[model samples]
Target: MTAISRTGAGRRGVATLICGALAAGGLAAAGAAALAPGAAYASSHREAPLISGTPQYDNTDVYAFVSPDKPDSTTIIANWIPFEEPAGGPNFFQFAEDAQYDLHIDNNGDAKDDLIFRYTFNTHTKNKKTFLYNTGVVESLDDPDLNITQTYDLELIKLKNKRVEHETKLADDVPVAPSNVGKASMPYYSKLRDQAIYKLPNDAKTFAGQADDPFFLDLRVFDLLYGGDLSEVGNDTLKGYNVNSIALQVPTDLIAESKHQPIVGIWSTTQRRNAQGYYEQVSRLGNPLVNEVVNPIKDKDKFNASEPKDDAQFLKNVTNPELPKLIEAIYKIKAPAEPRNDLVDVFLKGVKGLNQPPYVTPSEELRLNTSIKPSMHPKRLGVLDGDNAGFPNGRRLTDDVIDASLQVVEGELVGSKNDLGDAVDKNDKSFEKYFPYVALPTEGSRGKTAKSSADTKSALGDGLTGATSENTPLIAASAGAGAAGILLIGGGLMWWRRMRRNY
Candidate 1:
């Protein structure tokens, strides 16, 4: 969600005494709510029945690592609302006012965050008195196309309860007033978004904004196919969507102990209540929080009901997914493995985009051996590639995750090779060199009249072919008559089964 939409919600009130007690006891207040003892599990991505409705508060993806560009710092990137539309205006997205957005760093492992960076946004909408459809036009503002403006403020906080604290810091903890760029500057929203950066100490920097989403997965096809094998859809379908992002670049010394091996786990959250009576509720959390696939339940409504502060609770839910058992029972899949340990591992540490048989088993969280220093230009090998830069460490936009995951699941890492063949890297489109790196085509350039569906399909077809046709089956199979039929049948069965189940 955009920061501008979270205007005027009051700050959060102090937690209830019970919550305070839990916090004091070192227990996650959100996890107090227990789950059923022996239930099937699933990934947190679209697991929650409540968050499926409210995409903004949904925590999609989280990333953390020592910045390769700056050896002295760690960069944290969180994305929310996958596959966002560049022109989803009229009523665009925004974060929840009552939500508390946070970036958690686990300086000391043990699966807990040591240092936390908290952020909150306050929004204000102006020119409410105007009645025109386009408020910034000369006729509406009685001036050139610069009259309509929207503004917002931000706050970043640091915490060290049971963890180490730094003696010195670079950036001040204060609310920043971001500019209100209307239509005239619409073309420069990318630039305006970059201008919102808040530099940190030791040349650290941070920013939050809406940008063309960097993730590339054929979500529509996946949804249509339901929980079927996504291998057949190809990656090009994920191209060109948008998302909201929060990026922070910090010095490495602060993130790691001695720079020899700094292990940090990155996660994002949004809170609805503050220490004070102020209750700013978050409507969204994490990068690509809930836009990738279909939610069989009331997806949109559920998404609106969630908040990042509820993460511990979300974890609990995934640890014991009630829906998977239901799916197993309905499908009669041997009643599923007892206790549903599958989901626990995936939520904690499974590699992204690599789902083997029994996709819901729990595994260890992605583990990055920082001891293995990354090459300046490491081959973009994914998790299965014996490279540590992909999942379990931090996910990058260009990682060929699908291939890596498939190989690993097929036991390739264990010295067995089973090819799912090859596919394109949809996110390979070059990113910006600096802050707010995602760049998407402008809305005007992407409108229906500007680029029809047929045109897009043709363009995608041509692009996927060319010199790399031998590597991608989507291109090689484009003209195969029976391939489309087989895909349709497989996709249809999966879709029907998924739709038949009740969460």
Candidate 2:
């Protein structure tokens, strides 16, 4: 798991401005967004105390935004299975068949999911004789030579007062994209990945497969926290790591069903069936990095198990977080004062005019406005850069959330000045403009720092091959989240592949 650290503030300042064009004094097509806590580039990776044990069900990050290509549709992407080594094995990472992956929508700020999309997977091995992911993947998704395969089913359900009132399984059996082994086996990996995109009856689209972990961050927070050199902090720890991604593109009308409430709250969770046949919720994420950075050791599991409605209980920590104090103590930088209503306005209760609902109890959920128009030149600084189309409004793959959040963490509120950063600016790979906007996963066949067909070489000749070396050991969970010391992300000083993110 990649550990999150403080983001460096940037050239511009971000403010709590809510800009959405409401229609007829009702929920209309307008640009809007909610704020989430920003961690270092790692975002959420095995953060919870209990859920850390279940890596398959562990969610890394969640993203929701208005589609830049298809403006009418909203794009939602959730990542799982973090810090995946490209050459891990004959049996690489696959979604657990027993685990239920969910993307939830709360159109109103009631802190409850009104619409829920659930998915489950099943893996099949065509040939058990040899331990190979693919015997000879020479062709399409259903190639006969494709020895190992995985398929999934998706269901869209509606909840009224948290009771299941409606549920519908999507028409087709979703095919899970095979792991990018190598150019020798899966020669044309992009074509194979594109085939995984499935269109639904409602004109919605969904995809479940491997993708380049879109998160980028400097993992040097460990050293920086101890007053290390600022230039050294520029190294990105998450570069070249791959993650499992589930993306959905649905109409704005579907998410914003209530005409009165255009603003919707979004979050993701994973559940697993216990021996008793009862499903237990193991992991949950809304606002990024809260469980990993804010909660105490004893309360991490409790925070994961609790719902957004009960988030009021966690307010004290948010108002007076320990991270900034640590930064102040070590680096001598004065952070914001406690009883941080600014944070409450930015994260929990969405900005009054911007993303927050009319009546809401402060909860940590990524808030998005369905009506917001897409920006042609989307800025990495998001709302701070006046690119209302970015993070803190609705998260986009290109948004520099780490830097944005770092500015806020260090008291760079509205009408303030600042400049902080990790220097690693973009994702390892370029993002697509259309459905399933996340880029392709770095091939699993590549050794640590070893280049693959999917990887473009950097100026230093080092590809984004983060911590894939055989010598790299499995990092401990406690080293990753909550009150237990800051987590360790990928090893080595990372070298990023500079790419144009604007699509």
Candidate 3:
């Protein structure tokens, strides 16, 4: 039987909650997990203070959905390094070589992960003598002119009760798509991205590269909640930004439980090597705004380091949320009553019958029922609009989580129907219809240079001249100034070497 048919009671149960408190005139709170791996915005991108300073290892968003073109397979995409400016180059963006990026899945109702896909990257530089991200117009992934490149290894791990039962290296030395350096460097950026998509065993596929920041929403909500008058609305704050992404697609049966039970919970985390060299989870994400909007400041850092099995310790934040109270005080809207089991049902435990697994353990993760097919024209509001294949059921790239979350958090399910939103809707760029559906990264030379091939080649040739071409003259002049000049040159060379290493 299909998931929708089997979970009829669960859907009805949710409806009952929606209808029961129609007269309350209270705010419905938005709380749930997951977003398209390509999507951006919300607190998931640098949501916590400590993680914010370390963008490379910070998880921005996570997306899991039944592949639209290949419904028999499931696709999971996770992004890191939020708000990547295409023009921000020289060193550009690359996955952290010292960190482990992981996608965790809970096939059973228990909070423990049953399967994990771990990705680790390694960076290689061809011409370190030249401080250029690329020595010339990089035509391909393996081009020597592409001064810096990255490759990753993908490992599939099966676990039982939080212990690894088996481990298999699914892929090794897979090339990562280079950053969109611009028309001069990567005029065929899409072609480069296509080359990065790797076909794996069991008809699976994987991709790691730079893509457009798919998350769309006004980030100005921090300014006194839209200037306390809803004036801050309709702006797509992350429009031109880019993000580093890792995407994978596998057969539905691969990650699903038995045919009798098909729901799976998904989340992603980044474990960075601390000073002691032991990997420690520094960032985590599942739901769109859980840590950003739900967890308080004191718990934000703690939430990143915690596991879902221990989420009960933070239950009070969800049961008695502070966002609604803040909205109530500012907008004169009535806040929902305390001890909100509705939130626990939606955010922690999967909705009964719909996506909930047998004997659920009430943990935070994006839940998806493999039995549910993809929607051709999915609604942005997701389940609220009866689109079962979208978010809260595995986030899609097009789901308008910000608006949907706004209404849900303001009491759409518990009677207080509202249309509250930040006014932003869809992404500034359209998404691709094929595998690794994220939009192409914004170009570094967007609307600036339209250089000809000769012009580009000439520029690269000029850039190839090492630091001696420019700085040697200065050092020579300083040497003529005697002892003071020697000290200055020593300090200058040390600073130059450090800068080169950083890039």
Estimate TM-scores for all models.
0.58, 0.80, 0.85
Tell me how candidate 3 scores on lDDT. 0.76
Candidate 2 global lDDT: 0.67
Q: Candidate 2: deviation at residue 216, Å?
A: 0.7
After superposing candidate 3, which stretches have Cα over 4 Å from the reference? Answer: 1-43, 447-455, 458-503
Best by TM-score: 3
| Candidate 1 local lDDT, 12-131, one digit each (tens) | 132343222211111110111111111111113444665546666655555554456664555677666555565565455455556656666544444444566665555444334333
Please report the candidate that would top lDDT against the real structure: 3
By TM-score: ranked, best first? 3, 2, 1
Error of 1 at 35 (Å): 18
List the global CA lDDT of all models.
Answer: 0.42, 0.67, 0.76
Arrange candidates, best lDDT first.
Answer: 3, 2, 1
lDDT of 2 at 283: 79
Model 2 C-alpha lDDT per residue in residues 1-503, reported as the tens digit of each score: 01112233435242211100000010100000122322111145766667778788888888899888888888899999888877776888899989899999988787778999999899988766556676554357897556677888999999988999989988446888878876666778888888999989778999998888888765545443524344344455778888889999988888986646767888898888999998887777765555666666776777666677666666565566666666555455665666666666777667666777877756778888777688998888777666766777768899877666665655557434555545556887799878898888888664333243223222212112232432223222322353333222221112122223332
- Superposed on all Cα atoms, the candidates' RMSDs to the truth, in angstroms, are 19.3, 14.9, 8.1
lDDT of 1 at 227: 39
lDDT per residue for candidate 3 within 151-194, as digits (tens), equals 99999999998889999999999999999988877777888999
